[model samples]
Target: MEKQSRHIFSKVFTNAVLIIFSLSCIFPLIWMFYSSLKEKRVFNADVVGLPSNPTLKNYKRILENPDYHIFDSMFNSLRTTFLSVLLIILCGFIVGYIIARVQFKLNRVIYFVFLLGMLIPIHSLLVPIYIVFKNAGLTDKWYTLIIPYVAFGLPIAIFLVEGFVKGIPVALEEAAAIDGSSFSRTLFSIILPVTKPILTTIAIIQTFACWNEFSFALVLLSETRLQTVPLAMKQFSGQFSSDYPKIMAAMLLTMSPIIIMYFVFSKQIIKGMVAGAVKG
Candidate 1:
């Protein structure tokens, strides 16, 4: 009876702590959402309290304002994030598979090179990449952000995928080979399907990373049409100084898709990260 009582107490304590922590994390977003519905004066006057008179004027203004380009920035972020994740998963899987399965002279060396990319701070290369892009006329293009997103994203993807592939049974591949399956056929048909969990994990992670990236987008993209979420949101602040309500509206609008995606995929994400569960 005492042991049962102790377990109940512990579980309750743990739940209380978790609830508090979750509230702390989500409170800001809740505040932002409700605060967005207020007028500028009401928000500034009572930042903590709910608005006595909720209004949709801010939302209407952002949607109707041609200068804001909120929708365009959103589309750009989605397009770039999708393409970058696709390329990262594809390239990372291929390179990671080779490093895991093949024997070669420079195998370790090449794998370590990607590991080095993870070690190095990507933001440190901002100026150099900008310079190179400028010289090569690659800056401010639709594809410009995709390059860095894929490059930086590859290291982690490759690391996770290589480790995951290493755990896959070697007998499976050998059997495929013995059955006279071509390399491409075996790769795509057998190995690729089994790698879905880890790949899904990589896609989710890199989607958030690429979408939220601000520095590279700020440096590489100058044109308004080419601007991404962070960039357009920056313009939102600049264009509406001290108007906290309107700025929050812009942020809430831009943040909705990612928030929805996270809530939807939260379980799959947790499942994918478990060790050796990729094949399970």
Candidate 2:
């Protein structure tokens, strides 16, 4: 009875702590959201207080106004993020599978080279990358940010996929081989289905990375017509310092997609991370 009481007390204590922590983390987001509904004067008058009269004017202005171009920025961000995530997942799985399953002399060398990328600081290479892009005439292109996004994203993607693939039984592949399944057929049909969880996790991770990436986007892109969400948000702040409510609205708009994605895929993310990290 004493031990049972102790366990119950501990559970209560942990739950209380967790509830507080969660509320603390979520408070800023809630504040930002509600604050977005207020006018600039209201927000300035009482930053922490809730809006007594919420309005959709900020949202309408940003979305409906041709000058803001919020829609265009969203489209650019979506396009780059979608393309980058797709390529990262496809290439990461293929290369990681090869490195894990194949026996070759240069495998370790290639793996080492890829791993070297993660160790290097991206900020250190900005000047060099800019010079290279300038000389190559690749700057300001639609695909400029996509290249680095894929390149930087690949190392971690490959690492996770390689580890997860290693955890999968070799017997599965061997059994498929015995059935006279061609190599491509076995890889795509037999092995691919088994890797869904880890791949989903990789996709989510790379999506967040590509979407939130600001520095690379800033360095690689210049045209207002081609601006991504991060760049546009930054520029928005500079252009509308007085309009606090509109700024908050713009931030909320930018945050909505990622927030929705996280809530939907939250379970898959936790499961995949645990499986990939522990199983292998």
Candidate 3:
């Protein structure tokens, strides 16, 4: 009876802690969403209070304003994120597979090099990256962003993929080889499908990084038309007077897609993260 009581107490304590943590993470988003619905005056008057007068004018104004370019920035972010993540997955998978399956003296060395990249702070590379891009006449280009995003994302992607790949049974590849399948054919057909969970994990992480990245975008992109969501949000702040409600509304809009995506793929995300962390 004492043991049973202890177990129940432990479980209840754990649940209470989890609920508190969840609320802490969620409350800010809830506040932002609520503030977005409030009038500018109401938001400033009562930052945390329930709005007596809710309004959608903030959303309507942001969407209708030509200078805001929220839609264009959204498209650019989507394009950059999707293409960069796609490349990272493809390249990381190929490299990870080779390291895991191919028996070569240099394979471990190459894998170690990728792991070393993770140790290098991205901020440290910004100056050199800017100078090189400037010299190459690549500044303000979408490809510039794509290249660096893929480069930064590769190290972790390779780590996750390689870890997951190591746990895959070799017999599957042997069976494929026996059936007259080429190495590439075996990889796509047998290996990739099995690695889907880790791949999804990589995609989710890289997507979030690329989507939220502001430093690289700020330095690399100069043109107003090329600005991404983060940069656009920075510009949303008026010089003379800040509209807190409008800013909050824009932020909510900027993060909505990712939030929806997270909710939709929450299960896959949890599975992938756990599996990758464990295997890697």
Number of the top lDDT candidate: 1
> lDDT for every model?
0.91, 0.88, 0.91
Q: Candidate 1 on 1-280: residue-level lDDT in tens?
A: 9999999999999999999999999999999999999998888789899989999999999999999999999999999999999999999999999999999999999999999999999889999999999999999999999999999999999998899899899999999999999999988999998887899888888988999999999999999999999898886555436678998999999999998887898887776667335353
Ten residues in sequence with the least summed lDDT for candidate 3: 271-280
Backbone steric clashes in candidate 1, count? 0
Writing each residue's lDDT as its tens digit, candidate 3 over 1-280 gives: 9999999999999999999999999899899988999998888789999888788999999999999999889989989998999999999999988888899878888999999999999999999999999999999887779999999999998988888888988998998989999988999988998898889888988998999999999999999899998999998787899999899999989888888888998998999888766665
* Model 2 residue 165 CA deviation in Å: 1.4
The residue ranges of model 3 lying beyond 4 angstroms of the native Cα positions read: 239-241
Question: For residues 1-280, could you state the per-residue lDDT of candidate 2 as single tens digits?
Answer: 9999999999999999999999999999999899989988999999999999999999998988887778788889999999999999999989999999998999999988999988999989998999999899999998999898899999988887888888899999999999999989988898888888888888878888888888988888889888899988875565436687898899899888888878887888888777655666
Model 3 sits at a Cα RMSD from the real structure of: 1.8
